[model samples]
Target: MRRRNRSTDRWRLADDAGSAAIEFIFAGLILLVPVVYLVVALGQIQGQALGVEAGARHIARTVAAASGTADADARADAVLDTVVEEYGLDRSRVELSIACAETAASCPAAGATLTVTVRTAVSLPLVPPVLGLDRLAVVPVEASAVQKVSRFWRDG
Candidate 1:
């Protein structure tokens, strides 16, 4: 066989045409996919957080506006149901708690503070349930709101 020209061999080795574009595309994908997934997860969590906050506020207001304790409890439950539906949250994963600040013996007295807490779990998109890691794939969001009973309000 004839000997290859050293200059042509060197030129072939130095040829880098189209390599930069390919490298850039690979690097971009490596950096972009995780960033996009993170943004989507955060957005979903934020929406659920906002929904929980709004639901707490609605529950507190509804409870405070009720004419009686029984009415308040019923109305609060109804509002919670509506919020669960509106937010598209799994009812089994959502929890609501109502308490009277500084008093646990009875219903809130006039001018007493009523606190409503809403909690829910938001599952991350594209995450599959892993053995012993199911809870890690979900984010928990909670919100609380307080409303004071009107001074003229009478307990039922």
Candidate 2:
């Protein structure tokens, strides 16, 4: 005679109902991977922005130190390279654009300002490919750094 097996409490036991919860748990983890990747990408952008700004400040400081007659463009480029490297960016992907104001209204009354813009194309290796975001190819990341000339560099 088989005893009634109450040990298998059908109501409280795991059943088809729990299957959906299990699927949800797995799917949630899959979805969270992309979200976390995007957050990391944003952080990288922020870091690059700070690096560009620091480069600009360095350029401005260095240029202001030399005679106003010097060719600051080269020095500025070097400073930008160092800054990009410091920020852990690929030198090839990193692009820098600089502007030098020559007119009194633009550059006078204060030391020269160095505006350094750095941009790179960043791609999410694991997440984007799975989400069909690969069609976009690459996302452009941009940052700008501004540095003012020191008081000493100003023309009295």
- Highest lDDT: which candidate? 1
| TM-score: model 2 vs. ground truth | 0.59
Off by over 4 Å in 1: 1-14
**Model 2, runs deviating above 4 Å:** 1-21, 68-71, 102-114, 127-136, 145-156
Tens digits of per-residue lDDT for model 2, 107-134: 4224666555667765544545656677
**Candidate 1: what lDDT?**
0.86
Question: Over the stretch 67-135, how does candidate 1's per-residue lDDT look in tens digits?
Answer: 878888899889888888887777899998888886746666677898989999998898767674666
Clashing pairs in 1: none
User: Worst lDDT window (10 residues) for model 1?
Assistant: 102-111
lDDT, each prediction: 0.86, 0.63
What residue pairs clash in candidate 2, if any at all?
53-145
